[model samples]
Target chain A: MAKRLMPLLNRVLVEKIVPPAKTHAGILLPETSNKLDSGKVLAVGPGLRDKTGNHIPVAVKEGDTVLLPEYGGTTVKLGEKEYHLYRDEDIMGTLHD
Target chain B: MAKRLMPLLNRVLVEKIVPPAKTHAGILLPETSNKLDSGKVLAVGPGLRDKTGNHIPVAVKEGDTVLLPEYGGTTVKLGEKEYHLYRDEDIMGTLHD
Candidate 1:
């Protein structure tokens, strides 16, 4: 049996998306962006419980592309790939296309 | 009227306590501690709104001493004093005596 990761309490697991090195016009891309990083949501945790004990759903679901902050997140290594864990609120926004 | 800070959404306003340079026995003290900083709670936020807009009360109240993490907090300047703002959950613990 293969091990699986299940995030808890509104945490989201994401795999970063590496942008292409050059544009179609042959313009080189910067190594890093100080503002945001692109990633795909791998897993979503059950929503956090409010004071009243009601579950609050997370903002994004599995397979959603999201904008991530340049810094701050827990790094998790599963097998050979690297993943990041962030609070639902830390995910900036979802990509449309 | 003087300016007042009303923290919102489970934020806390605290004034850092500067420990004495030397112990009662005359041992010199270090400039900073990596573990925690002592602070007095000046104010507490109304509490973060859950998905359903329910209120969740903060853990500590004004005048209580608390343990603050070594880093990560918003600093605010009010009048001639400096204060720090932290999420209610970020506060480590309440200090006794």
Candidate 2:
């Protein structure tokens, strides 16, 4: 049996997208240029209940690329991979193209 | 014109209640003994709107004694008094007795 990560109550599970290690010219890129501020949404919660007990869905969905804040978001390590769990509101915005 | 403090969006205006400087035994208390965790609610917001646009009023009301968290809550100054503005949920609970 395998365990799958499932976000709960408007939480989002994201995998940090690390920038490419080198340029197309075969030159090593500086670590400073590799700002790990973007992530790919791996899973999303089933939305939170409002005051009236109505469900309000999160804005972003799975497979979306999102901008992350410099701080916050709980880091979770599963097996050999590391993922971040953030409240839906903590995600800055979704990236297009 | 005299200005008044009015909280908005389910926020509460609280005035910290500092403990008495001296004990009943006529001994002065140390600063460490004063936790400063209690407050008196002075004003409350009209309530925030839920997803369905329904108003969700704050639980605490004026003159209520509330327990506060050690951190968080924005400091507000009006006239010669200092107050704290906190969201309804940020207030730990209402103190009874």
What is the TM-score of candidate 2? 0.49
- Candidate 2 residues lying further than 4 Å off, grouped into runs, are A1-51, A54-97, B34-36
lDDT of 1 at B56: 77
lDDT tens string, model 2, A1-97? 0124555557788999987789899899887973448999988866666777676898899999999988887665443367777788989999898
Best by DockQ: 2
**Superposition error at A71 for model 2 (Å):** 20
Q: Per-residue lDDT for B9 in model 2?
A: 87
- Per-residue alpha-carbon lDDT of candidate 2 for residues B1-97, written as tens digits (9 for 90 to 100): 3458899888999998886677789888665652326778999999878777776667678998875656789998787778999887666445544
lDDT of 2 at A30: 86
Q: Compared with the real two-chain complex, what DockQ does model 2 have?
A: 0.06
Write model 1 residue lDDT over A1-97, tens digit each, in one string.
3356899988999999876677678977655422356678999998787766777778688998775655688999888788999997766445443
* Backbone collisions counted per model: 0, 0
The DockQ of predicted model 1 stands at 0.03
- Cα RMSD (Å) between model 1 and the true structure? 11.8
User: TM-score per candidate, in order?
Assistant: 0.50, 0.49
